[model samples]
Target: MPVAAKADVVVVGGGPGGFAAALQAARMGASVVLVEKFDMPGGVHTSGLQGAANEGVGGIHTELMARFEAAGYIYIATEETLPEWTGNPLSHYEKMKKPGDRFSRSSFNPEGAGSIMSAMLAEAGVEAMFGTAFLDVALNEYGDGIDAIIVANASGIQAIQGRIFIDGTGTSELVARAGAPFVRGGGPQPSGADWDGRHRPIPGGLLWTMSGVDFTKTAAHQKTAKDPTLAKLIAEADAAGDIPQGLYRPRMTGKGVYGEHYIGHPTLDMSPIEAPDSFILWQNVPYEWALHMDDDARDEARAKSALRGFIDAEAQFLRKYVPGFENAYLTNVGRYVGTRDGRHPLGEYIFSIDDAQQGRSFDDAVTSPMTKTFFWDGFKRHTFQVPYRCFLPKKIDNLLLTGASLSFSYETIFMVMRNFPWCTQTGEIAGFAAARSVEQGIGPKELQWDQPYF
Candidate 1:
């Protein structure tokens, strides 16, 4: 027999969304238990091995930045000290600034992010269960809300109860397991359409880290318009059939952080079905692409083999394209395949591309910001407003979703909100709202968005 524990609120999946929810709810005086499949926190920020935390858009997300800075986890560079790319010095642009001084979007050291996030949750008195996966949800006879959760860990399966539940799983697995009604991909295309209507699988990008990269040397080569020795190396590798072609627009972080762009394909976006008992509010494009793949055993093996090839290609690119990477090596694979999006529960007001482009404002708004839609290549100022209704499912009570899975249209999701920062903000709001719901003994639907709680 497994031991049982209890809490006022339980959060599944310890990513950014789950972390924020657990911290916020615990601070609001709710006893919170945060379950995670990994041994640490920060989700993609740490495990995904993605470069840094983006803080251009602020709020609670900024709080995490402040924490990172205080812990000495950030890199500071200035225009005056900007490394020369070529004969001309590459201009140093301030992306994020601080009060009094200019704040720049400082990239974080992944090694530090996990520790910092864990510390924050500890400070908030959140009981964190690392390496634990939520197996099933137990509901009361009335089916009002989740009564307890069955989880699998090193020991085995254990049941834990809570008054309220928050599903921050990046994939919406919790809600899906709870029997929610969710939709994956847009419905069937018109008849006779060339679209096989099957979700196609694309190559997943490789995540790699390079050290000893002398940003100064590469920047100087770039400024002078000279053949960037680094680029030459990459070209050589590609010609030798080591890396894939079409690798362009490498994203550089200050001096050391860099990423390569690869292939992307359209597929069914993964979104959870809505249920009377639960709601899903986070979704993204990357998740959809992976979920749409054929689930046949042969297909699964092929996908893994393809992923290995992608990783090898990336390793070769680093060795041949950039200077200081001759000694570069693969650091770690992301805990989960790099997923982009998931199922967005149907909410009262689904955010559309028009609303995002128009910078729509709402009377019952929980949060608003001017930001780029996810994965849009063009330069434009697009801001969006999160309506209160979007947080509530039509039938579910005492539930709120945060993270990338919020209700959004395909156009808006593809164009905006794909960036990770947007998900952080939504997660913070959902966390605060969940705490309020528990305190008032009412469902999130009952709370008036216009009313001032603070």
Candidate 2:
């Protein structure tokens, strides 16, 4: 492919990180181009219907959330009254559907998110190349920086040149392509010689949604101190074959809240599918092991189909034994699978577990303290700061890494990464840094986080 266009900054993803990068760079007066392999912009947050941005956020996050709110996509969780999630589903978001103090969540329509991304980018003067996938990179003659990137689309292969490249690709395809060092995603280290007592590597899985659920009824089934009927229903289901014998226990609740493993199967989050309607919700099914995203495409597709079967069985257990889901039907499944781990480009500095929870101060910190990041180990938690150097690579002169693939040790990555708000905040950092790099004719290797990129 021949060089098709030149951009002051080219963002290689369309997720929150990529979207924020493109918009931020452009707002800073750089000619920015955002290329998304997918048609929509929200990526997993939108498509996976994450439905929960529970961590409190601010900055551009405030603006984007306002749009989702105005569009009636934001649903705040509350410790108080949550509406009857089932029945003639109430559009009014009040009352916790499940029992106990409910954490507020924001669930939006994926289709709506696509439009919001477009408007935000356009308003910021960013040019977007949708449905374009990044392939590989061609480094400059000295191999110190990228010359251009090759991409594929309907018109075939084309080259996109930019002064700086931001890898918000989630998988860190650029780093992998550039033959950079990264951690391999797999099971957490086992105990003993293989065991590290502190590091429990939880497996990752895919997210899928179901529609036409009597979420009110489903919520009722999630027996809390306030309610017991849902617990009773699960007890009955477990006695019967519907809930699976030894391995399956029908907490019959949202998976995120409880990482319960029942019968013979591994732990799974039966989170009440978070959606606009009460009757519709998705279960983020955990896998037997963490998925390898770099696996062959055909193999990956087959694996997804297999995972869907397990999820379908889980759904069937609820429908057959649970009270609220008698007529519940499968409306949709996630287009992207959730990976707990991925490529972690070695950066100038990587935040550690202690840094994430207690909050470490970095002289070059681009994120505010209000931008909360945490790692979860059952009941325990550690919060930390996301430093600018996490995205700044040690080798790539003109490249910045964003999204879930930023440099972090296996022990602390998932706790620190994940979620839309945090990633977008980092995206803004990468964006401003890219613009500054171009303006000063400096590479990311020479950029300093202590100085203002603006």
Q: Which number leads on TM-score?
A: 2
State TM-scores per candidate. 0.75, 0.80
Candidate 1 local lDDT, 333-426, one digit each (tens): 5554444434556666787767866788788887644556333323456766668776665444655666655666544554246456766767
For residue 17, model 1's alpha carbon misses the true position, in angstroms, by: 1.4
Least accurate 10 contiguous residues by lDDT in model 1: 267-276
**How accurate locally is residue 69 in candidate 1, as Cα lDDT from 0 to 100?**
79
Worst 10 residues of 2 by lDDT: 86-95
Provide the lDDT at 191 for model 2: 29
Question: How well does candidate 2 score on lDDT at residue 68?
Answer: 74
